[model samples]
Target: MFATESGGVRRNSLKDFVNVKANGKIAMKLADGDKLVRVRTCTEDDDILLSAHGGKCIRFPVTGVRVFVGRDSKGVRGIKLAKGDEVIAMSVLRHVKVGVEERDEYLAAVNAARRLKGGDYTKRAEDKARDEELAAKLNEEKFVRMAEEEEYLLTIAADGLGKRSSAYEYRIAGRGGQGIANIDLARGKKKTHVAAAFTVLDSDQIVMVSDSGQIIRCSIDKISIVGRSSRGVSIFNTADGEQVVSVSRLRDVNGDDEEGDEAEEVENGGPEAEAAPQGNEEGEEEPPEVDGAGEAEGDKAGGGEEETP
Candidate 1:
């Protein structure tokens, strides 16, 4: 799967690259000034979520994109962008069939539980009783099932604020439509734009980099989970004139299987980092091998061969 910043998406089979050389082959032809933003492994049953810099996101089924037979052609539109808005991230999540009523009920229960866990004893008795009632209305088995399929989307703003929102808040819609608000852009005093938006696991760690070369790494669980359109709390504190430009998620490798562990080790170096031997016999350094495919800017096509889903 290849997703572009301009909302183009391409789906190709793994077998299509069976004979690909070390130089690599063109996975998808991109338009002028458009760059590939993601190359994640996905199944037909999964859903593709595209997040734009203007704080908008669209969710649609993977089946909405037809499997490409050639790599020279650009793919179909995954979302419609407003003027000057470009996609910042593309994430693939499991496709879960949840009704509107069920989703509302689950969210209510989850929010109530979160408030209860906060231990805010200063709340009025009626408010506490109402939260308890909402929590009790949730079916244990159904809640467990929803939890299994639930995904959290971590969205970061250029102004150093971020939050995790339930994926259920993003309703499934047809491809190539204007998306709903991903975050409240007007909630802050300073005008801000989305720096990064992608699905993350609670156990994952995130590293944020600012334009001033400042970096901050923290546990994903520390971020508060809030409504999709709500303004998030500060996750990073950028200095004056600085803005967050990049964010990366590091998976929890401790409990992974052998293959998963090896993959994570390779990913830590980055998608373009080669797995070749380090030094030569003379103890001198060797130049890294370059792939034939290149990006318009410095943005690397995310996920290398080992990361293919």
Candidate 2:
């Protein structure tokens, strides 16, 4: 765990974290500090610091400091700080906050997106449209980038059709970047992580990975295809058996399966035809027929051929 200080959040033990100092520690625009919740770091790892927010470590550096609760059969997860929290080694040291980094990265990205693509992420039908427009643009750009990267990961995994049988999983939940960041971590740490992920859901589903590099399913978040980006398209599974996959660019595998199954089916199912309005068989208009007499008469009238009644 860690303690928030003027310099920044410092490494702390579970036993030391107690109160929020009620004085020195400060909260910024986006951050909400538990006025009564103070923390300290122990000589140990961030576990005691973790205790402040209860055994739940979901909100790590965000919640102050944290410790790893032993992983049970259920899954890997954590909760917020505990009440009357004490079992923390709250270090009074300091570390830089990521909020600024987040803000800058998003700002730079959004500005670029606005200039390149004329989409108004800034939906300012309101009075404070200026700031609102800016924030909306930033958020949209961030989400789009996330979705595109996930698609890239999916395509790389679909190299072999033989991958349908096995799987991997991960259950990720966060308001911002934690889930994505953690997934990135797993991908790098595990062999063939990209080869195992196929469906990137907002929900967690992967479970296991073989030591050799194949993958198993975990309880990760389920990402949706509907209301999603047109990026990754391959469903993949690796023989190495690494379950969880990160949304990164192992390759520029994003594909547009535009003429996929649906397109091919429609084309092959019908005779060569132009797009036309539908109607009842009998109600449909018929093509004009030509009679031998009419053809001779028209030709004779045009002075091309003589007509024989």
Candidate 3:
């Protein structure tokens, strides 16, 4: 897995990591004031989505990043930050090919369904016109199949309000461009920005933590799924003076798989590293040394190390 820092990224090989000493080795160097914020495993085909507290986001394919021989190089810019904005979260998504018109129609259908569920089914001429246009362009059977394979993104604000939006709500863009809004903050009485946003599954649960140390867990399915720009529902009730500090997805504990088990072993200092396969057909590898000037590593930060394939 790769841990994204405010200024750069730290990465280690999954195969060779098992052979390293329990103390761990240098992964990526960083700038003096920068620190790690997020970690995610990546594949060549995966797209990286970086979210900022200012409601802007950037998406770029993983292959766009260069694989450095050493951990010392400062990583490339993943997003163009506003004057005071900084990255708070990063998510990996599978690449999907779809037309813009089709995606728009799908979102319209979802929004209409949500409106009906919320008891706002009043008829409108424009709504009818849009639906008719959508019906003529989308194949019902094909759209249903795509929806079955689609993933939804859940974004929560510090004020305890949250929403689930289709993954397609975020369009893929080049690295370092000012991104589109991840959620609407001006919809309701309270004015607050997004605290956390990540991909979620219907069967998943979420744990929201408050600034006052209060924590609440809710089923992902219970949260109202809505349009990307719509106002969200209240998923957690914070104390009068409290605000949610963080939100995380929870999966079934019994559903742990091989990768999860490996992560656990690494966390507990298990000796599976000694048994882990070493260099492939090649012999002992040399320590990598990066030549360019970039973000420099600082004093160690507190966290367990992760190795990615």
Using lDDT as the measure, the top candidate is: 1
Ranking by TM-score: 1, 3, 2
2 or 3, greater by lDDT: 3
| lDDT for each residue of candidate 1 in 1-309, tens digit (9 for 90 to 100) | 788877677787777778889999877776678888778899989999888777788888887665655566666667766656777778888999999889999999999988888857575888899999888766688877998889999899887899999999988887767777888777444657787788888888777888788988787899999999888999999877677877877775464332121111101111111111211112112222133232122334421111111
RMSD of each: 13.4, 32.4, 12.0
Model 3 lDDT tens row, 1-309: 353434234433454245678888766556665656676778777787776665666666666454543455445555555554556677888877778887887777766554544443267767666655654433588688667768887888667888988888877765545566776666345445567888887777777788788988677899887776565888887767577776767765345331111110000111111111111111122222333332223413321121111
Let me know the TM-score candidate 1 reaches against the reference structure: 0.79
Ranking by lDDT: 1, 3, 2
List of clashing residue pairs for candidate 3: 1-307, 1-308, 30-296, 30-297
Q: Once superposed on the true structure, which residue ranges of model 2 sit more than 4 Å away at CA?
A: 1-57, 62-309
Which of 1 and 3 is the better model by TM-score?
1
Q: lDDT scores for all predictions?
A: 0.72, 0.25, 0.59
Instruction: Give the TM-score (vs. native) of candidate 2.
Output: 0.19
TM-score of each: 0.79, 0.19, 0.72
lDDT (Cα) of model 3: 0.59
Output the better candidate (1/2) by TM-score: 1
